[model samples]
Target: MSTIASLSRSWSSRVPAKRRDPRCAEPIDVREKRYGYFPKMFVHRGHRYEVYAVERCWTVSRRGRRDRIERHCFRVRCLEGTFELYQDVRHNTWHLQRQVD
Candidate 1:
């Protein structure tokens, strides 16, 4: 098989590929932790990455009687790789964004 075809086949096989040497990281139960608003899918390079995401939202009260502001946060973890917090976006009273390393 050609390299491209092999790569495609390997990618389509969504099972977690073996790591040459695996290391342990702290286990995170995103569902229990953040209430399930984070994106469950991620893409890396030209392939899809299986990931678990945690999303949190809180409100900041405005002074006196003004309307409160809502803050949205996303925490994403790659099931096979590593990542970091990237950016946040606000739409009206909520936020939406992506995280990467």
Candidate 2:
């Protein structure tokens, strides 16, 4: 059987354009340290990455509705590299925004 890592690599390579484009944010699975606050780890494109440190974090409010949050953004560092991840509060879904470095 092919390993998950290998499968992820193959799948990612098949769609290089989408994977590389910052504009195309993809869905991801995230595990938060706190109940719903800080991200501890995340999986993107079938690859798991542990968050080493959170460089920055912020929340965006829905337009014309400051009381409602739109999404929560986090810039995090992992063993492989740095990434920007975000959680859509309204939908309660996570996405891999971009690879910072």
Candidate 3:
């Protein structure tokens, strides 16, 4: 092997692989603001629910299906007040309707 190649291999083997820091994985401020807090409600089946914001959502689709599904973590202001809640997976948009409360 060449001098350069041998040197590179020696150095690479000496270095330890970097690991993800648990603290860096999550920010303290965000944990303080949102962790352990979620909205509680019984939604009617056909009423409009006002959405203030969304925190996270995932789009999923099955094989051979033409349509995609979207799930949302939404925060909304309701008659009771504003709260964060997990919304069901609908089509492209979040469904608004009366939920049995």
Best by TM-score: 2
Cα-based RMSD of candidate 1: 16.4
How well does model 2 score by local distance difference test?
A: 0.82
Show where candidate 3 strays beyond 4 Å: 1-44, 64-101
What does the lDDT come to for candidate 1?
0.40
Backbone clashes counted, model 1? 0
lDDT of 2 at 43: 82
lDDT of 1 by residue, 1-101 (tens): 99999998887685343321122221222222233444455444445655564433333333335544343434456665444322223332221232333
As a TM-score, model 1 comes out at 0.29
lDDT of 3 by residue, 1-101 (tens): 99999999998777544212211111111111223443233333333344343333343344436565444444445554554444344532223321112
Candidate achieving higher TM-score, 1 or 3 = 1
For model 2, residues 1-101, the per-residue Cα lDDT tens digits are 56998998897888657546746888999855655588998888788899878999998776644566588999999999998888888888888887877
For candidate 1, which ten residues in a row score worst on lDDT?
19-28
- List runs of model 2 lying over 4 Å from the truth: 1-23, 32-35, 64-69
Q: Which candidate model has the greater TM-score, 2 or 3?
A: 2
